[model samples]
Target: MIANFSQYGIKKLFLPITSVVLLVFGSCKDKAQEKPTEAMVEEVGTADGFESIFDGSTLNNWDGDPTYWRVENGSLIGEITPETLLDANTFIIWQGGEPSDFELKLEFRISENGNSGINYRSELLDTIPFALRGYQADIDGKHRYTGQNYEERKRTTLAYRGEKAEISTQENASEPESLRNNVQRNAWQSRKVLESLGHMDSLKTKINNDWNEAHLVVKGNTMQHFINGILMSEVIDNDSVNRNASGKLGMQVHVGPPMKVEYRNISLKQ
Candidate 1:
C-alpha cells in the first residue's frame, strides 16, 4: 500500500513540473510569434509591387557626372554649386532597363531654386554627353512646375499640372471633341489642350518643401503622375510621330542657380 502511495505522490509531483514546463514553453512561443517575421517584413518592403533599383551604396548600373551625383544618406543626391553650374541640363541615366510599361515610385526633396525632373521613355542625345530627350515629370523648387509633363529637348510641356490631355494627330488639336471637351491650350501657339484635372491650390498644399512621394504610371502611350496620393496629371499620347515607344530613364540636373535635389526609395515595377 505504502509503495503504491509513494508512486502516486511521485506522479503528482511530475504532473505539476510538466505543466509548468508546458506553460513556460507556451509563453515563449507566443512571444516569438509576436515579433515580426521575415515574410512580414518583406511584405512591407515590396508591398506596392515595386522592386528597388538602387542599392543605396553604389552607382552600379547608372552613368552620369560623378561630381554632381552621389549616394549620400541612403539617397541619390544631385548638388550643383554656383561654381559647378552647367551651361545645359544634364542627366543620370538608369542602365537597369528601359521599362516601357511600368510604375515608378520614389521620394524627392529639393532646395529652393532647385530644378529637377524624372525623365522616362527617353533617349541619350549623341549631341551632348549624358543628355536625355523624352517625357519628363517635372519638379521645381518654386512648386510652379511640379507634376507637369514636359519633354526634354523635344516638344516641351506636353501637359501642364492639373490637366488631363489627349494628344493626337488624328484630329485638329484645336477641335478635340472626340477625345475631350472643355479643352483649352496652354499656349495659343500650341496644339496641346490643357484640360483641368484638379485645382492648383489644392495640389500645392499637398506638396511640401520636405520629402514628397511621387508615383508615376506609364502604360503604352498613356502616362500618369501622382504626388502624395493625389493624381497630379495624366497624358494620353496618340501623336504617333511624337510619341516615344521606349527609351532610357534619366534624372535631370537643370542648369540654373545653385541648388540641390535628393531622391530615395527609388523603385520600379514592370
Candidate 2:
C-alpha cells in the first residue's frame, strides 16, 4: 500500500511538470515559425505584362517642347532656366492626354537646395501658377527626402520618414494616462487599433542631394510612391484631375533662388 501511494504521488507531480515543459517548448517553436524571413521584404522590380515608355534614343512617342526638355548625355534633361520658365511658360505636357492607370520611373539630379516635382493628373493652367489640380510626387533636392505626396495642390507634407515616431508621440501625448499605460503595455495588440484609427505613420526616409530613383505606380484609384526601391507613401486619387481619366503631365521647376534641377530616365509602363 505504501509503495503504491508513493508511485501515485510521483506520477501526479511528473505529469504536471512534463505538461508545463511541453507547453513552453511548443510556444517557442511557434514563435520561431511566426518570425518573418528576409525574402518577404525584398521587392522584385515590375512583375509581368508592363511596357517601357522611353526608348533611349529619342522622345519619339512623347510630345513636349524641345527647348525645355533636351536629350543630354543620353538622358532626357529638362532645364529650368529663367528665360525658358518665362518665355515658353515652361511646362512639359505629355501630349498623350492621360492614362487611367500606369507606372512611372525616373532618375533625377539637382543642384544643392533645389526643388522640383512631377505633376500627374494635372491640367495646363494659364492663370494659376501651379499644376492646377492633381497629385504631385515631390522632390526636395536639398533635403535628400524624395517621393512625398502633394495632394490637390496642398503643400503641407502628407508623409515623411520618422512618420511613425511622430504618430506615436502624438498619440501618447493626446491619450489619457491610463490609456497610454495600457498602450505601452500591450503595444503589439494595439497595432490593429492604431492602424484603423490612422495613428500609424509611414516609414519612408529621405535621400539627400544626389541622383535618386523615383518610381510611381497608379492603378485605378490607388497611387504609390517609391524612392530607391523603398515605398514612401500612397494615396487614393479621387480628386478632380483624376476624374477626367487623363490630363497633362508637368514637371515643376519651382520658383526659387537660381537653383537648377535635372531629370532623366523618364519612362512609363502601362
Q: For residues 1-270, could you state the per-residue lDDT of candidate 2 as single tens digits? A: 234547568654546777768867997999998876666433334444455656556766655557556666766665566564533234455655576677888888877766677777666666754334556677766544456565333323433322221111223322345344533322211211111212223433346457788888878666677777876666543333223355566676565545566767777677
Residue ranges of candidate 1 with Cα displaced over 4 Å: 1-47, 170-195
Give each model's whole-structure lDDT. 0.83, 0.56
Across residues 79-191, which tens digit of lDDT does each residue of candidate 1 receive?
Answer: 89978989889898899888899999999999999999999999888989889988999999988989978877666677778888877664443343432332334321234
What TM-score would each prediction reach against the true structure? 0.78, 0.56
User: TM-score winner among the candidates?
Assistant: 1
Q: Quote model 2's TM-score.
A: 0.56
**lDDT score, candidate 1, position 192:** 59
- How does candidate 1 fare on TM-score? 0.78
Question: How many residue pairs clash (N, CA or C atoms closer than 3 angstroms) in each of the candidate models, in the order given?
Answer: 0, 4
